[model samples]
Target: MQLAANKGFATEKVLNLHEISHSLEFYANGRLVRNDDGRQRKFQGVSEVIEFVKRNGGERVLVVLPLDRVSEMNVDSIEPTFIADNGALALYAVRVR
Candidate 1:
């Protein structure tokens, strides 16, 4: 999230491809609760998710999945900007055409 913040991407706009919930409860006070609408669709693959985000005004993506999973997907268009020491996390800058 820090990387996204540094790149000026709004936290509300960061789409999680693996998210399955329609809404997230961020806070609650008695009967008052705050929720951010979640991604309702289940993406079949990484490429599809990237395209979806790109179409919705996203410029970058932070992947936290295993490397093997990501390696099996088509990510030729996305550029790797940062990789974690454990290799479990990666941040990519989506190329816009």
Candidate 2:
């Protein structure tokens, strides 16, 4: 959240179905989005939000998660287009085709 904020990405408060069921902070604009909290839930919350947003006309979403969660989360189902390692953070980009 701080990194994106420092980079000038605006904070978007998401209060909807997915947020109620699973707490996942998301920030985005144009083709990229970043996940703020990735400690308690792992990929379930983030993936759910991504799917919901994509269905509602989103594309090229990038979810930023903790580095340790790389092996824990189920990436096979979500199938991110690309994964980038950034020291303590891991970014999963979902590019809709």
Candidate 3:
């Protein structure tokens, strides 16, 4: 989160790829809200998630998963912009193409 902030990316523009449950919390309209309902979209794979992000005006993707899982993602439309020292977290910039 701090890295994205430092890079001047809006919080709304960064897509979290982690599994989100009903306990997720975020701010909407300047108020803290909880995702009690399972209304959040879940993607079957990384490709779908990237497409969704592109459709929704998002430009960045934050991946927090094992290296093997990351390797299985279709990265044809995105490129790595930042990678953590532990190789567990990565930030990708979505290509316009």
Q: In the order shown, what is each candidate's alpha-carbon RMSD? A: 7.0, 8.2, 5.0
The regions of model 2 sitting more than 4 angstroms off are 1-44, 95-97
> 13-80 in candidate 1: lDDT tens per residue?
32233433222223111211113462234445667756765776765544343444556335565654
The sequence of per-residue lDDT tens digits that candidate 2 reaches over residues 6-79 is 54333332222111222233333223323466322233565575665567676444455566655534545555
Candidate No. with top TM-score: 3
Residue 90 displacement in candidate 2 (angstroms): 0.7
Clashing pairs in model 3, backbone N/Cα/C closer than 3 A: none
Per-model C-alpha lDDT, please? Answer: 0.42, 0.44, 0.46
TM-score: the better of candidates 1 and 3: 3
**Which is the leading candidate under lDDT?**
3
Query: Could you give the candidate ranking by lDDT, starting with the highest?
Result: 3, 2, 1
Worst 10 residues of 3 by lDDT: 25-34
lDDT of 3 by residue, 22-92 (tens): 22234222211123583554345667666766775754544433444566445656655554424554444
TM-score of each: 0.43, 0.42, 0.51
